[model samples]
Target: MPLLRMFRVFVCCVLALTAMGVCGQNSLANQTIKWDDYTYKFLSTGQSAQVFDSAGKVVGTILSMNGDLQMIPLPGTDEEKLKKSFADWKAFYARSHSAGGSSSAGATATPAASSSNGGPAVPCPSTYGVSYFDGTAWKTMMLAVQMPKEKSVSLSQGFKDMGKNPLNPRAGETMIYRYKDPAAPLTTGPNPSFCVSISANFNPSQIMIGTVDIKKDHREIEQAVSSRDSWLPPKRVQQVDIKRVSETVVVVTPKTPLPPGQYVLGGPPMVGIYDFGVRASQ
Candidate 1:
C-alpha cells in the first residue's frame, strides 16, 4: 500500500509541474505583446494624458492634439512581436493592394511608388506625431519607425546626419517635435513639409523613410513645430526631408525658398500638420 501511495504522489507531482509549465507559457505570451514605458500630455488643454503599456514601460503617450503618440524602443523581446506585426502589416498591405480588401466594391489599394528623386508622387501620411482632435476629444495616432535597408544609401546618410549608431539605431528611441513658431500653421497638401524635432530620440545612428500608402491621404494633415537647422543645413531650409528615426516616427524638413514672396517668418514644427509618428498596435 505504501508503494502505491508513493506512485500516486509521483503522478500528482508530475501534474503539478505540467500545470505550472502551462501557466508559465501563458504568462510569457502575454508578455510578448507588452511594450515599453512612456508618457504624453496635451499642451493646449493643460490636461494629463492617459498612457498605456503592457510591459509596464510606457511605449507611447496619449495626447489631446494627437490621437496616440508612440516612440520606438530597442527590440529586446518585443522583436518577435515587431516581426509578427510587420508581417501582419505586410499581409494586410498586400490584400489591400490587390483590391481584395475594402469597404467599397471596385475599390483598389495602390502601393506608394516614389519617383526617382525618392519622393512620393503624392503627399506622404502624417506618420510622425500625428494628432486627431474631435470637438472635445483628442487622440494621437500610434506608429512604428521602420528603419531603412542596411545597405541602402538613405540609411547610411540618415545615420551620418543624425549621429545614430548604425548597428542598433532602433533602440529606445523617441522623438518630440518642437515648433519654432508655436502659432504657425503646418503645411497640408500634396507633399506637405515641416521641420525636425529637437527632443531626445529624434535622431539615431541610422534611418530610412518607408513606403507610405497613398490610399489614406488624410495622414498628411498632422504637424508639429521645429527649427530647420537642427538636422540639415539652412540652405536645405524648410525642404521637407523625410528620415526614419526607428520604426515610430519619420523626421521631415520642409523645402526652402518659401512660396515666392513667402519668408520663413518663424521656426517650423519638428512634426508639422499631418506628421504621423510610428507605433505598433496589439
Candidate 2:
C-alpha cells in the first residue's frame, strides 16, 4: 500500500514538473537524476533521493525541491500539505521555466488511494528513483546498508529510528544512516529493473546487484565486513545491463533471468543491508 501511495506521489511530481519544464541541465547525467543542486542540496548531484530533514520528513520531492523540501508533505503523507506544496511549487516552477502556469501541479488527481490488490487501479510509476514493477504496479525497493560490528554486519527489514541502534551494535557502529526494509523484495520478474539516482562522482555503469548468501536458519542476513573498504557495498556479484535513461536515472536489469534464490541490491545504501528470496519460479 505504501508502495502504491509512493508511486502516485512520484508520478504526480513528474507530471507537474515535466509539464512546467526543467530548470537546469547537468553536463553528465544518465539514468535517473531527477532533482539537482539547483533544486536542493540533499536532493542534488550524487545525493540520495531518500533525503530527510531533521523533522524525520522526506524532503526530496518536486513539490518542495525549488523551495524548501521540508515544507512539502512526505511522499505519501498529508494531502493538504501536498496541496499547499503544489501551490508553492507553481511559483518556483514558473521561475524555472520562465513561463506562466497555474498550480495544476499540486492539483494532481491522485488515483484511488491505497487499495487491496483487488481494489482501484494504481498509477504507473515514473522512471525515477530505485524501483521495479512487481506485477501490480511499479513497486519501489528499499535501500539497505549495514550495521557493522567488529567482524560482521547485520541487516534488518524496515529498520526504523535509524540512529538508535540496539545497545550492542558492538557499541561501536557508525551513525551515518537512513531507513530501509530488511528485504529488498521482488514478487515477480526474474530480470528485475532498478532505477539508480546516481550522484556526481558515481558512474552509472557501476550498478550493484548481487546474489545474497542465505543461511540455513534464514532468520536474517549478515556478512563479515572485515574485508570491506567502507562497510561493504551490497555484496555485488551479478553483472547487470546498466542503461542510462533520461538524465541520471540508470536502469539496471539482470543480464539473464535469475533463478530462485536470495539476493541483494545496493551500491550506496549507507546504513543497513537487507536480502530477498526469489522463489517466483517455484
TM-score of each: 0.18, 0.39
Error of model 2, residue 106, in angstroms: 25
Query: Taking the candidates one at a time, how many backbone clashes does each contain?
Result: 73, 18
lDDT of each: 0.31, 0.42
User: RMSD, each candidate, Å?
Assistant: 20.8, 18.7
For model 2, the run of ten residues with the poorest summed lDDT = 107-116
lDDT of 2 by residue, 120-194 (tens): 133324433566546556566654444432332234411321345444333322222322343344444565655
